[model samples]
Target chain A: MAVEDKLKIELGKQGVFVTTVNEIYNWGRKNSVWPLQFGLACCAIEMIATTMARYDLARFGAEVFRPSPRQADLMIISGTITKKMAPQVVRLYNQMAEPRYVIAMGACAISGGPFKQGYNVLKGIDRYIPVDVHIPGCPPRPEALIHAFMTLQAKIDAQPLTGTERPRHLDAAAMSEFPVPTQGAHDLEPPANRLVWPLPAPVASGENCG
Target chain B: MASSPYFSLAILFLAALGFGLAPLGLAVAWAKLVSPAKPNAIKNAIYECGLESKGDAWVQFRSAYYLYAIIFLIFDVEAVFLVPFAVAFTGLGISACVAMLVFVLLLAEGLAWAWAKGVLTWA
Candidate 1:
């Protein structure tokens, strides 16, 4: 629960501030999410527009698009993920520091979009790396990207500092490295990280379930 | 001692030091107490651009470029100082003229060293 829940507005109206360590930590983290600078295809144009003055992503405190994954806190997979580019994308996500977030920002990034039929495209980025938010659009408007940012902020805000459900960074047992898929003779070997994307359960022998 | 001017200055100095260092200390404490470090082979890799680094970062450059740089500096300084000296020749005293001459001579010595070493010749 937020510190505001305990103190309520009366104390805030009197000019006294109240907060917990978790509240401060979450507040600081949610505000300054620097996204990794990268784009794959058409959706990248809309992503760029979000950073520009028109949409002004700075109002939400995520104006900076860091060129290096190491410095980035969020990765907006803003375009189509081709089979060839999937490995490199996963590698960049792995390189990012803990408390990192990913927003699958476009139909293409969430799923292969129009390219789903194409042999060269990967179905979805979440199949490889765990995606925090999935935004659906052929190329979503700047407003949509901003909405995604707010959603990510909400997700960050809800995470408990010390608990079983606390974020991946706080949990020592949480896997730091999601195995980067390598090239094979036919396709990317071991297609997806099963930990993130679970395989479908087989049907019972006598079951007539559709 | 409290009434002394330096006492205030000492307090301000300590305040300034704390101002600079307090955030750094808090960040270190936060990392230790809150954030559990998660480092792996890919995360610890040298290059951050997603591409695997090719070849060694340490590579040797030819020393011939050093001689060229030294020769360039000698002439560049000579020209710069000589032009100013010529422009101010009427206002300059005899001692000033001697000082300018000495500066030029020092640069000339560097030129002579480069000439003797055959650094001027392009290999």
Candidate 2:
């Protein structure tokens, strides 16, 4: 028998069961994680496969895929995030309720995979939104995704419900929003640097406009 | 037991309110105590597939979609009307049966008309 089950049986024999409020709170959050039903690129197919009958993501209580960001607590970055899609991704992340988590689910999402060299591909989604876990693979298998979930669960288990340093979602001092990059003539401009119209003069020949 | 029907209703109302509000209150408190609240300019901005929204969300749609919805509503109401007649069939009179038959025929005719007009065909 599993150690927890054995412990539960022992507690039953003693006519008492003991656990902290934090344990119960973490248990509820960990079990019923609702991921946003969003996909970006090829890695999404693998992510979908994980939720199918054969894989059965529901067994971990995370199969409830919400269409709206407001109802989701997990954002599985399941594919490549291009420059054009970064703002929407960040927006969706911002919209998710407190105690939210982000799982970078593939090599493409983690570090842009083979597309890292592409001008339009963002190096990694972590540049904008805070990621809780990173699963590395060209497109990680369903099993790998499950392993990542286990890792995430372990991370959640370690968090203190009430402490000086709370989780990012609960921390009012932490970043709540990421700047949605604006589309410029040549590239997406970060909010810090808004693009000006009428291209500026190049200092030298063969200099890139951007 | 309370003799007044309103008394039971009042208890039920309180129970209903408790049922809805208790969990919501707990969640709000839990979030306030455990979660952090941080807001910034970029995070609060509207999402438009990562790009700035060029135009308003309102856009013209094909008129045929309205026709399709109207047809669906007509059939949906026809089904709703048939349910009561079906449940009380034995209690209903022969005239009532004939009236229902006429109703079904009228709906069938409407469906046939729509089919002939090619409104049923998805474009």
Candidate 3:
């Protein structure tokens, strides 16, 4: 046997396949989550709920929430981006080191919803930031937020970058348009930045509501 | 029970005060070391979701909306006080209940005044 083949055979006999390591690492990465500490509006409340006992966002591995942008890999934009605050949102995104993913977390962030007409509101988060996944709802239920995070993981692992597969996020129109409520904190950073994001996963299923 | 209220309230208030102080106070303490000497273009610029900012964000907001918000806050603060009274209904059964009712009535009277003045109307 040739050197490469012989090495493969020996390794296989020892139960160590080089190719398998890639799969294992990918699996681990796809499950573990480190979210950037940021929230723009009321949608952030639902984002926090996902991490609480009922939704338990930790099951899929995203409970760890980092306040400093440098450490976080996931950016869940959870609220409306008004004209005044849009620049700050972008600033926070740029501060985060890459291999990063953005989860647009509300109807307002996804399509500007009712705020699109207002001169101050940005039309969509995608207009400024690169969004990896879109979760639709005025403020989506916590379960949906978890679902969207899973969807992001699946897309990230599917090898879409090499042109082997078309990532689902590439299709923008399929994403939901977010509508803004008249009453909400304008230009306020949501209080959900302080959740126990990286918690121990208790169970796999969320029987409690979404 | 008499002392428990004072004790529990002390603990609760102290805990709240501690929570409020810890992060903000800690941040200010360490900020002198971590903070850069001078503000840069990036530092002054506002945050977009992930994109660069184009224009200034410090534009004017309407004064009328601010007035309405102030009025809303007055009622909001009064409502916040009622929650603690409601939760401890067993403790403050007769006297506290009557006192809260009177307080709420006064707050309602203010709301009525605002309503009559068109300050409460959104349209």
Candidate 4:
């Protein structure tokens, strides 16, 4: 049980602060969510705007955009992921230190935006890596990006430090690496990762591509 | 030992050592008790730019570059010494002026030698 459940708010008025270790841990984690400085397409422009003085992403404690995946806590997929770029993206995601989160920030990143019908564009990044939050927009505005950031922070705050539902980094049994797809003669080999993106059941007609 | 002059210094030394090590110890303990290690080949790879690294980092450079280094030092040292000499020129004595002249002459001699040896030529 949370320490807040047992402590009365009246005690807080007396200047005593009561919190569990988990709460403190989550507080620190949520506040210092440094995003990876990776951008793909037009949505990246909005992501940049979110960090500038006008939108002021620093107030939310996430203005530090890490150039390396090793130091980053969040990956904002802010554009279209072409077939050629998907492998490198997944590889970079795998290299990030655990307790990492991904925010698919636009229609392109979430579902390839208007490029969904394009042969070269990947339908969604979630087909390869697990996405923590999905912000839907052709190219989401800076405000929408901030909303997704808060949603990710709330998600991080809710994560239990210990339990079956604990995050992948804390759990020994969780997958450490998602397979990177390579380009083939016609298309990307094994188009999507079955582990993260399960194929739908076959239709009554015998036409299906796995 | 407590009454010794160095007793406070010894305490400070140990405190400094503890200050540096305590956080490291706490981090190790946190890793052991809270977060599990998950190492993989890609994560351990040398390059962090999302692409596989190709070719060895070690490559040979031409020994001919040493001539350029010597020639560069001539102008480099002259510029460094000339700035201070110019700033302090008005107040300097004859001896100081002579000393500065000698320094400039030495650098000029080196530059002359490099020019004679054709070191300034790009070829």
**DockQ per candidate:** 0.56, 0.25, 0.09, 0.53
Tens-place lDDT per residue, model 1, A1-210, is 655574756778889877788888899999999999998888889999999989999998998889988888799998999888998999999999889999998998987898886667878898889999999998899889889889999999988989799988888899989888887655576676788988663222223212
Better of 1 and 3 by lDDT: 1
Query: Residue-pair clashes per candidate, as listed?
Result: 0, 5, 24, 0
For residue B30, what is the lDDT in candidate 3?
Answer: 84
**Angstrom error at residue B17, model 1:** 2.5
- Local distance difference test, candidate 1: 0.86
Q: Ignoring the other chain, what TM-score does chain B have in each prediction?
A: 0.74, 0.53, 0.44, 0.69
Residue-wise lDDT of candidate 2 within A56-127, one digit each (tens)? 899999999998776788999999988778877877787776678899989888877889877677767776
lDDT of 4 by residue, B45-64 (tens): 99999999999999889999
State, as a TM-score between 0 and 1, how close model 2 is to the true structure. Answer: 0.61
What stretches of model 3 exceed 4 Å from their correct place?
A1-21, A160-210, B1-123
A151-201, model 3: which lDDT tens digit per residue? 988866653332334332233333111121221244323211212122333
Residue A139 miss distance in model 2 (angstroms): 1.0
> Where is the poorest 10-residue window by lDDT in model 4 chain B?
B31-40
The count of backbone overlaps in candidate 2 is: 5
- Report the number of the highest-TM-score candidate: 1
Of 1 and 2, the candidate ahead on TM-score is: 1
True contacts kept of 3: 0.23
TM-score for all models, in order of appearance: 0.74, 0.61, 0.45, 0.73
Name the candidate that leads on lDDT.
4
